[model samples]
Target chain A: MMTAIDQSEHHAALENARREFRDQLIDADLLVPSGIAGLYGRGAVFEDIIDGIDRVVQRAGSAAHGSGIRRLRFPPVFPRDSFEKTDYIASFPNLTGAISTFEGDNKKHRALLGDRDAGLGWDHHLTPAGTMLVSAACHPSYSGLTGTLAQDGTTMDIYGYCFRHEPAIDPARMQAFRMHEFVRVGTPEQAQQHRDSWVPRGLQVLEDLGLSAAPVAANDPFFGRVGKMLAANQLEESLKTELVVRLYDDLDEGTAVVSCNCHRDHFGVTFDIKTEDGEPAHSACVGFGMERIALAMLRTHGLDVARWPARVVAVLEG
Target chain B: MMTAIDQSEHHAALENARREFRDQLIDADLLVPSGIAGLYGRGAVFEDIIDGIDRVVQRAGSAAHGSGIRRLRFPPVFPRDSFEKTDYIASFPNLTGAISTFEGDNKKHRALLGDRDAGLGWDHHLTPAGTMLVSAACHPSYSGLTGTLAQDGTTMDIYGYCFRHEPAIDPARMQAFRMHEFVRVGTPEQAQQHRDSWVPRGLQVLEDLGLSAAPVAANDPFFGRVGKMLAANQLEESLKTELVVRLYDDLDEGTAVVSCNCHRDHFGVTFDIKTEDGEPAHSACVGFGMERIALAMLRTHGLDVARWPARVVAVLEG
Candidate 1:
């Protein structure tokens, strides 16, 4: 049996891996530490690389014809009620970020200002702002499709900044990050086909950008003891797959830069989404973590974009 | 004298204006409210408009020669210490959003999860995550430039999503919005010239986009009675100018879509930034509020982008 000690050891190994990658990024001047554990300031070159990768990923998505894909953009912070309906709080309570503000009267505000001026913590005065930072790009997309779906189904391309509370030294895992997701709501077979087709396409997109990547079965980072069992069940059912790339030449393992997941009626049931035939619509999404892909490119091809391969340059520029 | 009664009346009028704009946006399906005041999900058409405006603004920025402008992008959140150094807490304490998480042990975690599952507020367990959501795009840019500047000066183009706590039904006043800012650091005169030149260029950019924009003196939305005096002083000094456009056919007043600001020596003093000549480096910036510009375009030239003037379409497309 995997004991608590085993979990501790596993966590320590992950921390070391994160530190190694962080050191290399810092050396390259690609990342400037924000004095926060999981947050960092990316320089101009890094920003350019991210922009190039995003463009290519967007182009790759354009090949999905006949699906009538609608593009949507959302703010990182979401309505608290909308978030609660997704059941993310019950599943991953620790990773959620709630928006709050100081809701005190004038006299209390004066004291709050004084505390800030005196370098005393002023967070105690913060009241809930009736919103929560988004944990996934597809949450709002799924919520938006609540009532019913057409017989032919619907597709959406969404991009947004997402937040999580898992603060770490890993350059790969950010507290706040960007996610580009293509979501489809349809029949079970249709949803499965949508994700499966994207698996090879996702890998090819990275390959075109000059990064070596592969798809492997994966599981969500569920929390605690019961979460361990849930994760095992997910892996057993093969519900998730990741497109991973080696972050460093010396590292034996690869980082998951893109994820393809089939939620299979879970969201439809939760959001009360039904097909025109009166059946629960199954959902699937292919998500590319933009920053991770950029990091992977930097790691595989080196930090200098000018020295990058010709094909990569052509794909990004063209 | 502006009494409490006057403040209440002013707020009521602002609320009415916000509702009018909100109703118009809803009718156009350009905005889907997130059930949170000042937050909305943007559709593809709205996204396209925003993208067009951003591209044109970037091209307009390219006209600055010899400035050697560097482009930078930052994540939405910044280090808490770096955020505190900006002294936003001392001024606008209520408008800041600090990132926090539920940092509790497994036993406490179970209780936290239970509370969330039971529909009890889970935010009480969230501890500070050591970072805060950004209030301005230029804050990180200025923080990154702390230390010394060359005698020739430094120029930077920054774009990022910024957050504020003000919540209303106003379609224009988003809690989370994108800001495109061009910043300069040099001697006072050089910084002043950078801002002054941008005023006409900003107006022209809007004019080319078929929106009649005029640069009018403006002030920041400072807080409280002391802030009112500060705003008056800023307006008197001509430190800020805004490109305004009419939001409604019924209203004569126009909204500020863009702002040109001269922050002479303020950031230098705050961040200890110095020039090669050992004098405090003055700073100035021209910021284009991306959503506001898109909204202005939608309001001024109907919702149909195809029907826009030939010159406007050419500039956006070309």
Candidate 2:
């Protein structure tokens, strides 16, 4: 158990790290704060880095020995019913954003307008729109496969804007972010093997891009006191592995840019996804937080793209 | 003025046009609906077309003769204060979504979870988070230039995921979409000239992609009865021009896939942006609705990208 002083020291250290990234990003003009914590406008240089990282990751996937992957793209929001079916709110209720709207008649709208003009809030007039911002890229992918899977299983590459309502001063933890994920659904053994192999493959991809990365055991960020126990169970089961890299020269403090997870049958049970053999299909996914990885690259290398390592430049520019 | 019957007829015709596109997209498996109108998960083919459109659009900008353009990227949400400052609520109150969260404590969260478990609504716990989904890509771009401009002025290429709350079954009008925009801040004449040139350039880009496009006078979708007058005034002043393309075989019913607008110091005044000469900087922007353009391409050329025109395919695949 951590003491109060230890906890405070840890908090300060984390703050210092966040400040270092925020200050560098601001100085390089790579980020423009919107006066909102954990949300900022990224500049061209930052976007270019993201684009480069995307290319490298995609290339890595294509080079892998597998059946061609089906690529799917989704908007930031998902159906509220689908979200509920996933039982996500039960685990992480505080981390989701529901998309709501003002569904009032003209008179009520006039009232809303009045509120806006009177410097009062207009949100009171807003009603739930039966949808919510996506909490993960794979949510829709799994929801899309609600029924039986193929006998040989399936592989999909999915990307989308994901949202989590964890607002903080830390640039690494964005409220709204992009996620690039590769998901596979098959027998339990096949799924586990895929995730185990991806742990190293993810690291290799980062290394090929001139980033120093190491895979470490990790767990999902569950919420509440009960969630602490769940996290502990997850770590004990070795359900998640992350590829970590130092954002700065201090190797002791590393950030997880890529994560690989094996969900033994969690999604299959929830979404009624079954293999052709009539059993619940196991699933696994490797997700790369694009913005965090790009930020890590910027933090590791200098802000100048030209000054980046030649191999890294070649991989990105290629 | 349109009669009540004429207005109803117009609405029906628009709905039919939308249905035509949605049906075609569904048949092609390019889209998977998320149980909501105007919201869908895009498949690989759809994503590829979007990618192709982005490349064509970017190339068009780079090939343009001008001073180098600064590129900026912003996330979907913006500071509520900045949004309020823009006074968007005065005109389009019905068409925006705010990013809010559940700020309740752990006990409150437990109660929320109980409500979720009971199948009662849980959204009641959410409160406004002081930020809103961006209504336009240029909102942040203009907000970023809130101070003074250089003598020679500035040109920026901004892109972002934009949102509107107008839910419809029409695939042509998405609730959440991407907008690729070019914004210029300078003297009145300079801004106007830039917008005027982009009108033709936008059409040319579409033509090169084997799409049939025409420029026409247009107006923003202002709300309420008062909004009609505002829209008429806007069109009368020739403030907006759009590149229209037929979403289906019916050429009479065309959609605006790209738009060019001259704000004439509207943003400058609102954001307190001034030129080096001590005058409010006039601003103009040309925005391309990426999904709409890609959909237009698929509609015009057919769903099979491999069979597209050689020139168009080369430009996209290159």
Candidate 3:
């Protein structure tokens, strides 16, 4: 298990290592070539990497639109009133960012200071979708699904970038990460069945990829006054557990590559998700910590990526 | 081009198709397993897919950390003040939300309102990460990277789930999507070289993964008054060209799966991303639209993931 002490040391060491590596790459001319569309040296290689990602996404058996999983993508921003209805601010005040309008003196100073090369001033930053974040990939899926979905039982798998405001530097715990989440909605039996099904399979995926993994109980990093209770309940019921393993980084504590959680109707009820039979659906999600997995593979293999096993190369090539 | 009219129609059809596919899977028993942890069903098969992803990540590259890329997971929340500095609210007012302090109407009502459910005259629903959705993955990445990164130029391929408030719903143009962004920071030469190098490599990867892709010019979805000028400048300078191809949902408009952007020094100047060399480092990114590519793969092969080509499977299985 990773403790605060372990995380702190890991963060410092990782930051140092990353800075060094970046310096080396720059010195060696191993970077994006000019003329590549977006910023750095973009070339067919980047496209190839993307294509490789596509193939993996397909093989994951969670094909989009089909693959027996319901897929719904909703607006990233939600109504401010929507969140207020849920009491999010009170529970996690420090972690939240609210978007507010500036119609006073502050707003005027911003206008006058325009194009000072300071970019858009603060006063102009008024938008209704303030503080809202798709903390997890499944939130939007639940919200969108509830909007017009039939009251019948449904299961959905939504994948997207889940963001957080952590100030850490551990590669395993990124501020921004790719989350491949499979969300389900239905009766308790249905939700539990969904979570139960993916556990062993998720393990197998790790094994097949030539990686070692273990399923362990996990908890969200819920901070502040409510965190203790949240943690206690999670441990008590074993509601949250993640698969942990060692990756390439030199961190003392291993990383969590996969988190298979059973939200247990937490979201279904919140979003008014109901089955065709009008029963409030219970929901569960199996989230793949994509970067964690990637780093794990790197550690399992050699540092020289070119020397990676042919089999692994073949998978991306295919 | 993904036009307004065509995009609307295409999205509607895609949604319908998505629903139909989900229904079919349930009827087939192949999908009844639901979650990844479910019993031996499609979820179990996802294990196999994960193996493929592991292989690819290992073969593609290696960082010093270990096998997986060293990830710096940060808190998923940002301060409200930070967003305001980014000018997000004014540019997209309708898409923003705000967290607020609610002063009750009266002593009795205020006291009652303290209990969210009681105040609302109903049970309070579950609230996930509120309005702090990431319009772009780079926003958070930049926030995290700029603060602690060594003055020396550094580069990283950060992956995350990016959300957008798209009123439209084309399968290719999702509201929530995964962006595999390879960002680099360094001198102009280093940045340009990095971008340039990926172009051919990107093409190769796509071909190796068995997808048809081509480079084409693009423009951002800038809306409103200044949006036109921004879009026009981007188009004229070819600032937003992407490598795109036709997806199965619609064979007419070419869908963008990979976008290679050259941010030049925009973010560098804005965030004051100074390189170890003491000069403002230029930056660029190669972004992969993971879902679009997956959708393309489904259309290219067949809806039935099992029937994918042997070669394609081989690469993924690697």
Candidate 4:
């Protein structure tokens, strides 16, 4: 489970490994070729990664539909009403990033506003949207798709920057990273077909780039008692698995390159996403961890980036 | 200086060109090829562009001084005190992005915390850290350099994701973009010399990739009565000029592929950025818009990213 604070040495070790892995990516040219030599913030990298991830998904959708895909991008911040209906905080209480603002006198605002940088203190900041941090790209996509679910199943490949407070860091798991989830809403068959099609195509793309990627059963990082229950449900129903690769011989922090989740009727019932027959539509999605992929490619490939094979470079460039 | 918002049909056309340019880049195999397409915010493309631009500048710095250049990467969000001394809000009053919070009543908090999605509104968020949205990457770098100038002359290359309130839809002029500013601090001569070196190098980069670029004097987009005076002053002093290129023959928005600015002790006086000789240091920076370059590359090369010249592909892959 993700925690707000920690002193666990085991968890600390995992975080160190994650940090080392991040450095390795920079060293490998998959990350900043310049190296991670200075201070950087989670917010900054999160923002950038989110942007890049979104771009790839958008281009992919455009390519698949040639302008037929309706684009709907939501604000990073959303109202609480949306999440309440979805039961996000309740389902994963500990996992939700909930924030509230401080109310102060007008004098406080003036003091802050008068001096470009005054001591307004952390508490003076405004209340943040409840559970604003998107845990998954699909959350926002679902919000955007609430009343727009097509009976024939609409396909949306979206990008979003998501955040989580994990005590440990794995090259496969990031505190913040870009998540590219391709969501499909329709009859169970249609959704499954969409989900399954990606595996082969994704593998083919990897193969073309000279990567040896394999699909595997996996469970997402859920939280507390409810999270465990959610995972159990997913496992019993065979709902999710992520594609993994070992960036290093140490399995302690091997990376997760792709996450494929076949959400059965969970979302259908939640948002009333139904099919032509008015049955709750089944939804499934394929998520690609762009940073992880780049890290994997670099770990598998070479650091100088100049050394990437011509063919592989061609594929990536394309 | 950044403006809150502005929109024109011309802006929309530029946005279209930007989209087309991104598409072309995907086709050229120059990038993994994302547009604002993916599930996340499309801002990743903007971030990637900024990073790419920084890489070019970093490479240039390395070439100039093999390992002597101290590469420093700073946090995007800094302590509010830093901005106060710099007078950023006053100078770029309209452009700064401030983070504020709203504090809710106990009843409201209980109601919000109880609901899954319905949570605190923005009105109750906390007072923002005295931060203006960063209009340019140089602002933070300059602020850091204050009170620590190398009298003899010091050249430092820094990169950061910058934000601005540019309501214009021109892809080239985005609300946020990555800026790679190769900054030089020293005597007037040293600052000017640093700016001069990039002229040939930047052009060579374009030529090597088979693109034509031109250099032109430029003016900052300032607003209000005082802004007009500032703009006039800048013109009189010849402070800003951008290396531009026509992305499309039909589009009026040419890419500002590169920009070189000579701040003649303006920052030195403000932040007390001094030199080793015990005098204030003048500073100058050469900036490259990473996204615009990719756009330029798309225009110069074909969009079938796979077919981009092997040399360029090698650089990107590296």
Best by TM-score: 2
Between 2 and 3, whose TM-score is larger? 2
CAPRI-style docking class of model 4 based on DockQ: incorrect
**Fnat for every candidate:** 0.66, 0.66, 0.11, 0.04
Q: Give the distance in Å from residue A32's predicted Cα in candidate 4 to where it truly belongs.
A: 5.8
Error of 1 at B154 (Å): 1.4
Per-residue lDDT tens digits for candidate 2, residues B1-318, read 989998888788877877877877877789887777888889888888888888888888888744489888888877888888677876777787876677777788898888887878877887887777788898977777878888878898888888888888778888889999998899899899989999989998888888889999999988778789989999999999999998755535588999999989888888889998889999999999999998888878887878888888888875
**Cα error, candidate 4, residue B14 (Å):** 18
Model 1: lDDT equals 0.83
Write candidate 4's Cα lDDT for A1-318 as tens digits: 635454375556666766786666544323331111222232223334334434544555565556544333332333344555456544444344433332334454344455424533443333332324456767665544454455466876565445443323344554445666777777888778767776765565456646677777667655455467877777776677666676755534355677777887777787766676778878888887765675566567765556778877655555
The C-alpha local distance difference test score for the whole of candidate 3 amounts to 0.54
**Candidate that beats the other on lDDT, 1 or 3, i.e. the better one:** 1
Candidate 1 clash pair list: none
Number of the top DockQ candidate = 2
User: What does candidate 4's lDDT look like per residue over B1-318, in tens digits?
Assistant: 424343466566666876676554434333331123321233334334334435555566678767655454433333345555555444444444443322334444344455513543433322342333345666655555656664456676555555443334344554444566677788888887776777777776666555688877776765445567888898787888778889766557466788888888877887787787768788888877766676677567665556778876656544
Instruction: Identify the runs in model 3 with alpha carbons over 4 angstroms from their true place.
Output: A1-318, B1-132, B141-152, B248-252, B275-279
Top-down TM-score ranking: 2, 1, 4, 3
Question: Candidate 4 at A241: error in angstroms?
Answer: 1.4
Model 4 spans with C-alpha error above 4 angstroms: A1-110, A113-152, A159-176, A200-216, A223-225, A248-253, A263-282, A302-318, B1-112, B115-318
Docking quality class, candidate 1: medium
| DockQ measured for candidate 1 | 0.64
The TM-score, computed over Cα atoms with residue i paired to residue i, of candidate 1 is 0.92
